[model samples]
Target: MSDAPTTYTGAVKPGGPADVRELGGLTLTKVAVDAQMSNNCYLLRCRSTGEQLLVDAAAEPETLLPLVGENLATVVTTHQHWDHHRALADVVEATGAATLAGEADATAITEATGVPIARTLSHGDTVAVGDCTLEVIALRGHTPGSVALLYRDPEGTPHLWTGDSLFPGGPGRTTTPEDFDSIMSDLQEKVFDKLPDETWFYPGHGNDSTLGAERGSIPEWLARRW
Candidate 1:
């Protein structure tokens, strides 16, 4: 194991509304950028191995590029959405990292980003960065191919980077008529019920919360589920 420290720093663009938070570790730097007041884009770095992972490359690659550069190893999208993929082409150009998304959304991601989908991911796949691993969990509520990345801190507490699955107060929106029930069912059975109460949720939008907080809001969510 490397003996590097995990440090985080935040920076805001001069004329832009986005804020970039750089979390540095022994081998990786996890950079989270708050974009368009709602979406988030993350960059994971492996210092020892020089491998990096870019999660949900949203708009403003001009703002996100210097941090990503040649160190990027792969780009993984939680799901394919306009706001999330708008900056992908710039990222691909800068890092040459293979872009990955769910099989169900690959075509849409490709169409939206104008970049080929290099790999299709499914539930239970492990995305590795040096010795760290993020296990994929298909949430499938907000979008057909929506997924969550589950990782553990040194203490073993679960930390989830849910693309658009479960947010601070609830899960993401379901526009397709066929996805409403599946999205809610998946939330209750796969996400809310399966993960421990202590799991920290880093959603695609809003502030971070825990599974316990989200579980408590299920009734409120169900009441509004339409």
Candidate 2:
């Protein structure tokens, strides 16, 4: 896999393929697989312990397995979305890594893939990833149990893994008015209103973006109501 020039602490150039970048003490390896949709799979590793976390088993397990290394500690599903878990079973089978998902969608994700969820996470819960920690943030509306993970470096800079909840230009696809409103509320309170401008966000699909670059478009996204 080629290394993308971008990193959580640096600017991202959209359309980059498989790449590995550093985030202080952690290493984030990204790969965009062509599946039902353009799904981005991330492998995060703690430099100190080599314990790794694989975020969103999107697709192409054969390709992802190598990047994930042998120290995988957990395989976390962002939501119960089929596209995001197409390769979940494969990766888990290969790595024997514990599976995790939001409590609400835990059963569905397990039933659909036959890869039992080892643990169900709730909002504000911290997932121990080797020497590092990632906080869970529930993001509903995309899927009833959608979630995003926030990893704060030693310097306090935040790096979020937004699984189809908040994207570059707007929130994820929500059909009904109620669903749209729910997602919008989650994005506002848990995201925009809280995180710092320089926080780098890695979405489930496509390129990554910083909070500062996306904050200005909230009003426009609201006006569009998508």
Candidate 3:
């Protein structure tokens, strides 16, 4: 076995210590940058090619830029939310990295950040982080274009970036019953049904949780929709 850390605790705080986890051929770093909202930004690096990808520029460009160094390949916005891309313009300008988001929310994200998305992603799209690829899962409800990224580690468990869609307790906060139902349905069909219980997921805010841990709560989440 390698000397790298085998266990990952996905906890982070504002101006964070930045929890990091090592997987086969990949390293995952989670940072909490937006102090007010406590938004989480993830930095994924490919050990073989040294290419990096940032998920959600969120806020605090100064805090994010140094971690980026000189080799950022792409920045993917999970949704068109303002808090999620607050530092998009700054980060992209500093790194000249390509920008990506779900197709439906591309225009809104550009409007919010003044940084046009280089490519609009879809439910089945694949994003490359050097040699490794992340499969995109479009989950509406939190936002019309909210999306999630799934990474299947060859030597470990499947990892997911859930954005603001699914959290530890239940699905994210939705405005109306319609929106709540929409997210719940997508989470059921696309995420819970398709993925294994062992899959570990990182959320957009707060701590992380696994599918196995949250599986039993689905019924409760449905009964008491928020």
- Number of colliding residue pairs in each model: 5, 0, 0
- Residue 189, candidate 3: C-alpha displacement in angstroms: 0.4
Q: Model 3, range 1-226, lDDT digits (tens) per residue?
A: 2223746678788976887888786888889986789999999999899999999999999989998887998999999888999999999999999999999999999998899899999999999999898999999999999999999888878889999999999998899999999999999999999999988899999998889999999999999986
Tens digits of lDDT, candidate 2, 109-193 = 9888999999998989988789889999998888889989998777546889999998888899998888888999998999889
Query: Which 10 residues in a row give candidate 2 its minimum summed lDDT?
Result: 1-10
The models' CA-based lDDT, in order, is: 0.72, 0.85, 0.92
- Residue 177 miss distance in model 3 (angstroms): 1.4
- Using lDDT, rank the candidates from best to worst: 3, 2, 1
Better of 1 and 2 by TM-score: 2
Candidate 3 lands at a TM-score of: 0.97
Regions of model 2 farther than 4 Å from truth:
1-17
Q: Each prediction's Cα RMSD? A: 3.9, 3.6, 1.5
Ranking by TM-score: 3, 2, 1
